[model samples]
Target: MRPAILAILIGLLAAVAPVAGGATQRASVSVVADLIERAAPGDEIRVPPGVYEGNLVISKPIVLDGNGAAVFDGLGKATVIEVIADGVTIRGCTIRGSGEDVTGEPSAIRVTAANATIDSNTIEDALFGIDLQEAPNAVIRNNTITSKDLDAGRRGDGIRLWWSHGCTVEGNTIRGSRDMVFWYSEDLRITRNTVADSRYGLHFMYSHNTVLEGNDLYDNSVGIYLMYSNGITLRGNRMRNNRGASGYGIGLKDCDDITITGNALLANRVGVYLDNSPSSIGSTGLFESNMIAFNEVGLLATPNTHDNVFTRNAFIENEQPAATHGRGRLVSNTFARDGAGNYWSDYAGFDLDGDGFGDVAYEPRSLFGAMLANEPNLRLFVHSPAQQAIEFTARALPELRPEPTLVDSSPLALPPTIELAIVDSGIGGARMGVLAVALLSAAFGLVAAMGSDRRLTAQHTGGGA
Candidate 1:
């Protein structure tokens, strides 16, 4: 009887243990705004897969997780999510349609506090996708943002951060916006993003210690606009196809201690435009190891901008001059051909010796280039015979040409080449030798056939064979 009683007690205890252990602290609420309002700090709000069409304001630290693919539509009027608290994590939600307004500040998500993580979200059809004001130490990662309103008066931006510092914007795709500006921000890292079809892809105003890397910027009015910013580094970016009335791939205005390297600037109106303000003087910049090709102007260093270095760069196949306004150090650059100078398609000088450097120092600037600089419409005569005649006469008489500025003595090395011998016994060379022998045999057969035909005609006519 005692053994049976002990067995019954053990079975009852096993059955009751699960009920006690499975009792968890759960506060599952389904209402959209009410659930967020009633949730306390450290609470988790699991939003189911549904449409929540209202403005969300989180004032406490919590985790807002979309259980499935949830969406929050702002209906083109107000901001979608406004965060006033720190340490809030919003992830995996679709926020859309915070369109432009003449009266209100329309942004999909706006964060005011710090230590926020906004990741893996889709924001679209908004005046501004994500607007952060005074928010520091935020990680905005893997967000797809697109704003369709890009007219002159619409005033939309994909990601506009004002006075926000220590932000990391990584792996975001921004499109169809205008003037995506970051003003008074510091220690910002924008990397691995695709920004296009906007007025300005990444515009920094009075921002310091910013690093932009591995970004693809194209089809914008300005790829990267820097105004009154300092200590910026732009590396491994590709800027192309920024062609319009007033378009530039990269425009630097009144910025200092900027280092731009390993960038590809292709087919823009002005590849890199260095503008100098009245208050800006003795500001130094470095452009190194960049491929500035097929642009109207590769480097346009306007007057009053001094002490810039363009070193180890490839300026290839520019329509006009390689560089405008000669005030910088151009060192070890490739000019024309596979030589030490740049690979200028219009180089008429000769490389007399076997050394790769050209004999004559190729002056990339010309009088016509300067004339077109003053009157950009004159560039329409680039292919005209009149321009060709001027170029020919200028080559013949150096006195009529513009004064040449020597930038660099040695440029980067050319691409590697492969040589093949026609008569070698190797497979590649033997194949060429076989083709040559076949051609020669066919020629010899044609000659023999003509001689035999003449001999047969003479023999038939009783002439000596």
Candidate 2:
């Protein structure tokens, strides 16, 4: 009877071997978990090539190198990998299948430990790509991240640093996600990252003393927005084609001691929008050597924005070079410092003395610009004859001429020499094609409508005659 029972158990094990050895590979999955349990701290675990089911928690310091062939799939449940141990390194792996429930805040990789290096990982189909909560001194580099196939607003952030300080996020490409945000995370060195096709490319709140250099942010709603963040240095960044509602290439609200230099703000709705920035009295903001070009409004500021210095920058070919949000004067902001002012493409003044500086000051005092400042809907008439008539009437009647929005006392005769190296993500394939078709269709329709309106006006005038 005992031999009969043993024979029955062996037959059951043989029958299940085919299932375990096939697609599920449950034995390899258990082997990894068992090995992790048996390994000591600081062990270098090189996971073999396989699609292992992941709900992994690395609570001890170790180097988990996947060699780029190991894929950890979470089966669309909670976080795939959670690192609670400091000094753990997770790299060279593909991590996916995080739960899509936003309420649970599911993520592919959640690191709550300090000094973790999450590098060169391909993370996709995850709600939140990589979330670092209270994880200081983390190095998140060279990771390609994308969120789940939810709406842009519903998709979680591609990379979020919540109260994580002294972190370096470099050389990462993030797309189709909500934002790459830093909340209360300070002392960050965020450089050389490309973020596109999402909401805010980079959003910072209460994060101070950060240096953002060589970042490319485009095709999004707002390129970079800093709220209540102070002592930030934005240098050598390219912001382009961000034309959503409130599409500012760089926006600063209630921020202080901000330095914006050597950056490119191109083809946005507004190049830069400032609302009470340098909010603290006696605080200073600096804008110099930057190229602000081809935007609807180059610089849009609120009534109370004050004490910002602008020098040696180029403002080129914007519809309105500078304007106020509501009723206010821009005399509070200094357009010239140290005998140098910005270069204005629309400056009608001459360099009579060959000094490379305009003899007359560049003051934007257009009547239509003032009207658009108070009532923004007038922008629909941009580039139309109606806009030209309004400006002509203002020139004919001096009383209609509004005060200058801001004056560049010593405007440069030539555009300032500033170069920004923008990274091409090569991911704007079908979306750009569709956008081009829509823009061409709208332009042709506008031309046809304008021609019909002119013909009708002429016929009505002839009938009255």
Candidate 3:
């Protein structure tokens, strides 16, 4: 008779389970620290599904519902699920091994208090997967944090928000994990995160009024490393590639009021690396309409990084669309603001007032790009023939022009259609027939010295703001 109705429903769930001091609220994996030391204070601790191991210190307001097949294993020795108190959550568990002991800083889910949540968990082979010390109004959402521990110097940050504040780190996916940091946090709201590989896929120090939108930083080594921050707002992010040894699609050091707009900075290696960063003043910082393509130096600003605002940005096919560090000055920074500028795929300049901007002032920088911005190994003789005879002696000796580091004045004979996504950058369809016959014999000797000095009376027409 159906085995006596399955032994009368397993003797009515062992006669109402609850035992407290004796521990038994229907959870398993060997009593899970005696059912969270006899859970109470807003208890819900379901956690059934399997492998529980050790180190679980939940203080109180519990929830820990591992409905997604639990597996909390702290074997690397501690911090598998710390959670001090205040409204804890730790949902859909699978949190794994932590404890690399960088000062006992092990973690899989630490959360030291405040409105905690840490949802959709899957945190893998960790060192520090979701550690939000000094935890404030937390919400580390849609977590997946990983780190098959490939020695990223010593894995310890897939999500670390020390001295945390009003947090909301959303839709996480972080890989490898050396940093997803936001030290000393404040009004945070990081969105749609996806950070990849390791070493900094978002590392803001002294975190300030943040608002990073639609994040997707990839192949990390530096895909967003703002230091000494200020009211930041990097919009519609997508920093990609991120090659190393100083790779960057966002490295602002002494940051202040940053506001990079409509971003895409692809195949990064120095797309937006400012030293003293957009230190705000009047207009309050800006790097509008970005897509500084195929980097090798698209906007390596440094010369005092004065009052920021590099308007309508889109210096495509960058082998150097402007650079500066030392002796590479004169970017008195302000590449056209209202009359509009910025869109230099090596602007040829000739907008005789047809108004899509490009009426002269286009100097886009290059004494061999100021020696690859002060000796970046002169890039293996860029286009040899002695670098096209030093670019035809800096365009027929305009006093060997190499000063105006970024004065676009209205430059853009094409390239700023703005709604940025550009990253094909075949880099001028490749060529090297001896540097294409030394740039076609330096463009027929610069067209026979501009046809004996007539110089074609200014006339550009590729308009398309």
Candidate 4:
């Protein structure tokens, strides 16, 4: 609870002002919803360490400061905390035990209020962790939310923002839920969070002008997926090992003006899946400086995909570096910008002049591979002698060349080096410094303890008096 409160305090100082209107009519509540019901609007309710039974509602513009000591248990029948008023603040509490009824869609905290803040709370065993419906500019930060271990269909989103425009969701670790869903939410800034073992770490539908950065999304069905969204920027994120049924580090469908840069996508089925992305010829999607490695397919695009550009990204050790479905070649997408292309691990082209560009065009897929891409059924016989012979024949015969999946006119023979800078500003830098110092101190203490143990062992073993 102390650790949880500390996390909240770090986020709170920036989001919320110092508790104003000092102690005018502060009330204390224990296991009673009536206290909150009876409190006046804009009043402060101090909840001490105890289990508060039944459902609670914040109908007035007020502060429910639990300080990580109070636990609101729903007793398995209702949504635990419901905020119905504007400017409601629910902070530093453990809220759990939401109803599992499919119709109810119960959540640990459900907010219908604008400008509400839910911070520094540990929420567990909930159907939905925090459901915000039309709650514009709501800030959810520094909360740890875990949902019930149920099927993806039954498990609701850890935090759902429906029509919650201009909201800021940051520094919350979420797991065991359907997804962190943003439906029709725009201008959102989601950062510094970790999500694992979920359906989709982040799911966006009709969400635009969203910025997602410094987030770790792993072991999910898909790390991040967007459908029919535009103006999305994903940076400084790590997405790894999400080899689920539809495993993709990031899946884009008809998305436009996407800027996915400075991100790492590792060990997923498809590092990035682009389906009709950059929707129109006029729209553009830029993939820049991303590390896409150790995945089944580094970049999988539909045959008709166009208006998408990939530049300065590294494709390493993927089963298929770049692939297209129903394809001879991807005619529309550009692999290189200004004669500088991505670094492909399998590119054997030479850079003789040391200009960092391959003299020959680096093509990731051969003619046979392109055929297999269009006709995926041929993949089953990939290692068979017949398939190998056909591939060799295609290589031997210049006339039988398959269309290039990715044609990099100037691919980098050597891997392009990109230095990812960690944010060292405000609380982030302070936190990193504290962590480094703590780690060094711990290492020194361990060394001293080992030395002492060795001396004691020598004395006990009769090697020394």
Judging by TM-score against the true structure, name the best candidate: 2
Considering lDDT, which of the candidate structures 1 and 3 is the better prediction for this target?
3
Candidate 1: stretches off by over 4 Å:
1-30, 150-153, 277-283, 323-360, 412-465
Residue 211 in candidate 4, Cα distance off native in Å:
1.0
Kindly report which residue pairs in candidate 4 clash with one another: 68-92, 367-402
lDDT (Cα atoms) of all candidates against the true structure: 0.74, 0.90, 0.78, 0.85
Q: Native-vs-model 4 lDDT?
A: 0.85
- Output the lDDT of residue 253, model 3: 88
lDDT (10s digit) by residue, model 2, range 54-100 = 58888888888888878888889999999999999998988999999
What TM-score, computed on C-alpha atoms, does each candidate reach?
0.76, 0.85, 0.37, 0.81
Q: Compose the digit string of candidate 3's lDDT tens values, residues 222-330.
A: 8899898888898878888887777888999888878989888877878888887756555356888887888877777677777777788888887776677766564
* Superposed Cα RMSD, model 2: 9.6
Tens digits of lDDT, candidate 4, 53-168: 77887788988888777778887877988989999999898988889886878999999979999999999999999999999999999999999878987898999999999999
Q: Which structure among the candidates has the greatest lDDT?
A: 2
Q: How should the candidates be ordered by TM-score, best one leading? A: 2, 4, 1, 3
| lDDT score for candidate 1 against the true structure | 0.74
lDDT of 1 at 85: 95
Pick by lDDT: 1 or 2, better one:
2
Please provide the root mean square deviation of candidate 3 (C-alpha atoms, Å).
20.0
Q: Which whole-number lDDT from 0 to 100 does residue 259 have in model 4?
A: 96
Estimate, for each residue in 237-261, the C-alpha lDDT of model 1 and write its tens digit: 8888887666788888888888887
